[model samples]
Target: MQSLKEGLLNRAFSHIYVEKRAMEYELTKEILKRFKESKVIEIEHYKDIFSRANQDFYLQKKSPKLILAVKQNNLIYKGADVCEDFGNKHFYYTSIMMNCIYDCEYCYLQGMYTSANIVIFVNLDDYFKEINRLLSMHPLYLCISYDTDLLALEGLTNYVKKFIEFAKENSDLTIEIRTKSANFNLIKHIQPQDNIILAWTLSPEGVIQKYEHRTPNLKRRIKSIKEALDRGFRVRLCFDPILYIKNWRDEYRDLIEEVFSNIDADKIYDVSIGLFRVSKDYLKRMRKQRPDSIVLNFPYDTVEGVCSYDKELSRNMIGYVYGLIARYVEKEKIYI
Candidate 1:
């Protein structure tokens, strides 16, 4: 058996698959510098590796590889129904990368993608150009980091900084960068902009310890949010996808209290409260991936292809949390 340290070293990007075209990009070159010891293999397209079959997602996640490629088409997508649009008429989301570094047991990425290896598109200029074209028509509310946690991978991709600068220049564009990472050093130096909303997803400490693998604890994330608020950034608190655990109400109540005690609610841009929901197909696939996971195995009701708690349970969950948050935040700024 391999020692734990040796196993970790083996899993940490032993090989890097780079597209022949992406090899020329400066971002690709910078990423290569960080993994000099890993073997570099050139491919014609990233899908050649990322879309392969018979791959074990769980095993590959032990030490996922890196795929650097250029995005050729479909730069932006319409936001899904499950996602909160915040009443924006021109709401959309774009994925510069796929698959997250963290191993959250309830993450939808596990079912959405066939591989656990991370894919980073090196051509972000193209994404910005597409956004600019859309902006020409009307104002846009874009979610820049939906499929992956861009902030956590900021050291390798530097996309968060680039997006912040992009949002700073385009006043008509409001970008939401949601993350569970505590890597505040990446954005501490840059000045925050009103158009750029830094949204952090918070879960109870019990949930974080049980389900959210490799993610920062609740306290660390709160500290990062405090720093962002102090720097004049528009911060949004998200108690989304509140897990249904034993004593969930008490757990979440304590979580809310802990959150409010640390920061001033007046500075918050908004708060979003949502109960757990996932696509019916995605949940089916998730069940096949990890059949033993208690969180994934819940018997949720399906409505129009979306699986979630029964209507009454979901209503109570959202309503209870909404009531808790409303005490600290204004009702007008809260979204369900």
Candidate 2:
């Protein structure tokens, strides 16, 4: 978590650009109060700066600016084919924010967006209205934190708390809030809801230290998960996007063992596993952006438009991990 002096970032922003229309929002006023040190520039629209060309993503990432805007349309979207649905037919995702605070080497966002600046949509009431409309149609499975870590930014946004309240009011809506953050205390006071699945992406310590930059350590994350379970929240463990780091087999093996050692597999809602996979276009851009990154430079095989490790390696990795997890968790409870 960022300290009070750091305000919005570890690479703290010097300026926060607010949309002319967004200034009236309660969230905007609340955030501005915290960052009195920053220069608050009012803009006609967020994209005037957010989508501009020739912006240096690497340099911007070091001290990214924050943009407060009102999201105009397409409040909800069908889940991409590349994303795992976990057996839900109505799988969908919505982004209240544009970028993440942590910078993982294999992150698809680097290839997906041109700028690294963080953009927050202040019109969250609109998002809730859209979800309410969709819920009328049928039961919905929504990924609320798809593009950004809402939990990590909860200190500034209070978005996760709002979502927890929204989920409680609508039982038919199943929401998945995935993150690498260890900031569970932000919402620990709220009563846990069965429809809200809190997911933490678990990587080996070596893997986290090497690539998952600026995120919490393994020990801290496990401690948070334990607290969540003790507080009666249904927690999900995600070993998804298993990277091919050196001695990865030993690393992941110990990771699985360490997790089950402290966490009761029965108490865990479920486990999710998957190998690193990205779009061909995203991989191409990532290779260009991070030419020196070891993870990005792997000679992955392309199946259709997606790039990933060869089928043999993927199968071996997943199968091996599956066996280890199955020792603790039921096979049916695991999602590949």
Candidate 3:
């Protein structure tokens, strides 16, 4: 067990809710040991609290309680169309953790979930068991960290480190751990695996400050990417959900240049780009949660149950950003 560090909020878990059946799991015991100062209460099930009526997701975000429970079903799921597949036929994702510590307004998790508390499913072994069973069918492209930032909570859970080791043992399974946390040092000593892709989401400093709350600044994330590359890890840069804020062109142009200037584009696995788009249901919930947020309050056009900037604007924005990045990275290595 590695020595645990403080959370991104610079505070320990004040209160931790543990499921009755989950207490015996090794992962649960490891987490409990890390946060000895937290108040632990055993519960029958996670949904009893996680699904309570009107949990005020926005207010609870200021100080979200931690929930450790056993994931009884749906250990893994097929990738959704809203998410980019990068043309992989065997794409899938698993949510070992629910909700994120960082509160980015553009994040779809806010609108998807009714509660804001953090839930870490301590049944990762079951996940791997199911994945290995499916691997017998064919190769897999797995997104290990979906709807949560495992890297940011690494100090408290160390789940990312565990996933890296699993990927190392199974070369047939390709795993992508996308994150905004600059916590690469936690696993710097571990050998890098070819199947493990470290995908980092990047935005301009100004945009990060104004919209991406509680996330590391552009410089810190880029520095971490450089370190990961220097350590021979396969790195990927995600410019998805490109916010349509004022001066977006200048912001993204400079962001791309800054990324290529510090990162060797040739060494990166691939770069992905997408404009901000949300499901109709999520957008409705987001409007109620953040009535005044410029990111969510935009009068986006709806098409086929999804909402986003108009088609022409989306094309231009994606085109301009792609043009800038193409100069640094080969077009074949880029994903729309």
Candidate 4:
């Protein structure tokens, strides 16, 4: 079978740009009419669909499968550390959307959701109100792009800019927009907020070419990051899910040097590091769905439901990268 890139964007309706208030049902109807023969996975009726360990998203992640875009529900978790530690702080994260625009084979979304259909929770005010209520007690560090790359879908959903505006008013809240998108146009519209940190996930050029699928290349991402930093955005680097590839050391060394060479290290807020990892349940589904994926086929050790490189390899990779990064960034700014 040909790669998804063969004609990923050829089907015009595959990516429908809609206004924020456009009813998801109406959008679904429009999509279904456009691709009447395609499958539709109705997610509004399928609550807790992603929580299922054995869910197969590839079956439903396609045209006409309109996952109802609902308001982000409850649970304002602020007690889990999201930055440097595995699980340390009370930083909170809430998902305003589900699924992503890019189709990265290594992404856990395929295993986490039963539908590939994008779901945009139209009720943004509800989340803002909820955060306000939570902020009554403690300052919150909210991860807005944890579940979806809001930047990539900015043309359809202007959530990030809205969130930035929201943060400009709510100075007590720390908002992080983590993304793999090269959509710098969206970031340009809004002024950089002191509390809003733009986090970009970086991978070596080879790794991105081999596994990242529709996401922007490393150079594009770096260019975007540099632009944001130059414009005074509090930028964070995420060297995450570091894959152990052939001559990975040389590749990553070059990547690190290349990154620091382009951007001002002093202006950077911090750098986050994490080895490749995913739930074993998610891995099983992806492996079966994409048997040809080298990322899935690689040997991984399972701890509970999470599958990652063996402990030794994971440690060595992080340690080596940490040492390489220490040369450019301060010890305090590095998070592992």
Candidate 5:
């Protein structure tokens, strides 16, 4: 259990674990008071926080600030086609939360924002409004998590559960909830939704052990997803940001086998493949904070502001992973 403590907004907050039984009213009140001036992008009753204009304002450097956004009436957004389309339309993603709890060495948040303190959007209804507007236009594939893993933070906030309920009610839209956390207790409370897909980013055990910090191990993560599937949840496997590690193919091959053997392929909604990539500017900031991290030290090419594996290598890696995964799932169910 993590305890929530108050500190100056300028200082980085040490991780606080508040026990479920010890969630006192005073603590919530004090936290609300301390973060009073943070900002309210929008608030809705039934939906989570939609969007905030000031989100990019705090990305300059890591300073601890409590961001609490309560979504009120409008929750959904008419998503732009640019967010989901890749190669031609562009990769589309939407974030209901502002940041993440785990600190992966290769994560963009370290370079994307300065503060470690989390921002909770207390409202959920307003976001639904925006989503409704978008669904009316086309058969939309919406990435519910682009920035933060709402499922990881499900213990603290039930926003993901509520969102899952919303997705089940509205089957016209495709929603993807991507996360690395292995919190399974939260899923027990809800029935699985067909249109809502739970995508887990599968990295080799060595890669996760070496680079991912404060995240669940591969075994625990796989077990969690299995639990979701046992309850009929639509599961999606994502082998993204394939690292250029030694014996990479052997490691990834074993991982692919491990995942399919443990979970049912027929139940899988889709599979996504991508190689490691980060904005060059973001990588620079990550290096300064973690000077010895190998993720920052890797050789990469600059495309626009993003640092990535050579184009040929990236293409090959994506192809290889996609092919391997295709062995278990149909091609149409595979998304790269």
Candidate 6:
């Protein structure tokens, strides 16, 4: 018999929700093969299960089920003002998946989605076609894996491989795949492309252990970034959404030193810094979902429907971190 700790550590989804149309695709079959033990339940639409009322996002996260579905309308959206556009005129983001594998206490997904189950949109051709349409007019900058960690799901989804191939073929389309995963082995074989930026969101070790649950440690993420840089990939370091914790100045300062120590500062494509901010609606939902999370319980100020640190504190935090990072890299290479 498996010990209690062993059972918890080895806990995989025992249930999988499949859209009836998704069964027609090979990707769905491939994913199902990996989760052969999971009981498959077919449904007409993913939203039927995903958008249900009063679903326990917290409980479902314990052993979240997987949903394979075909994406419908609104495949691509203009990037939100909250995100850094990096001077791209045509900044946009797409959700090939909803919800993330990691259960970070500060993640907005808890408030954005009613359920915590991972929803994988199996239809890639539609997304690519839409991008091609947009590219026909002008150059495009898209974040493909913004909603979920494609690298972490590479073993099952292989979406990262497909997106990389797509980017290679379309030189006009620049893609940013952001992740907190240390799963570099998944893309180690693929040659890096100039237009593709693999952005890694690094948090302090203390923050990761306390608030960012299930995420790779700071050292592991830095190591992954170093490996990616060594492999000729254009890597972007994101210190955005810097949480306010005890001794935050020292924690983040030490983190920056550790990052530059392991990775070559000159090789980084760029660094992005932003203080923690969430939509007013999302924060309300998050508070209800995680009542005890100190990361989410901060007395943030609401500015135009977004909740974040007060102007003075926000400026101080961003300025301090930016100064620390600028010491290692050129100021022009850092984005606010």
Over 1-336, each residue of candidate 2 has an lDDT whose tens digit, in order, gives 435434544445678999999999999999999999999999999989998988767657768899999999999999998788989999999999999988888899888898889999999999999999999999999998989999999999999999999999999999999989999999999999999999999999998998888899999999999999999998989998898888989999999999999998899999999899999999998888788999999999999999999989999999999999999999998999
lDDT of 5 by residue, 1-336 (tens): 112322332343322222222233343345545445544232232122112333332332234343454434334444442133423222235656667767677887777765445655544555777777766765556777767888887866676787788887677766778889898668766887777788898899998888886689999999999898888888888888788888888889999999999888998777777777887888887787777777788889998777889988888787788888989999987776
Q: For residues 257-288, write the lDDT of model 4, one tens digit per residue.
A: 99999988999999998887888888887888
Query: How much is the lDDT of residue 99 in candidate 2?
Result: 93
For model 4, give the RMSD to the true fold: 4.6
User: Scored by CA lDDT, what does every candidate get?
Assistant: 0.92, 0.92, 0.89, 0.76, 0.68, 0.90
Encode model 1's per-residue lDDT on 187-269: one tens digit a residue: 89988888999999999999999999999999999999999999999998999889889999999999999999999999999
What does candidate 3's lDDT look like per residue over 111-171, in tens digits? Answer: 8999889999988889999999989999899997879998999987878899999988898
Cα displacement (angstroms), candidate 3, residue 129, comes to 0.5
**For model 3, what is the C-alpha lDDT against the true structure?**
0.89
Candidate 4 residues lying further than 4 Å off, grouped into runs, are: 1-68, 75-88
Candidate 1: segments with Cα more than 4 A from true spot: 1-9
- lDDT of model 4, residue 144: 87
Name the candidate, 4 or 6, with the larger lDDT value. Answer: 6
Better of 3 and 4 by TM-score: 3
Where does candidate 2 have its weakest 10-residue lDDT segment? 1-10
Q: What's model 1's TM-score?
A: 0.97
Better of 2 and 4 by TM-score: 2
Taking every candidate in turn, the Cα RMSD to the unseen true structure, in Å, is 1.7, 3.6, 4.8, 4.6, 7.5, 2.5
Query: For residue 169, what is the lDDT in candidate 5?
Result: 68
Error of 1 at 66 (Å): 0.5
RMSD of 5: 7.5
Error of 6 at 154 (Å): 1.0
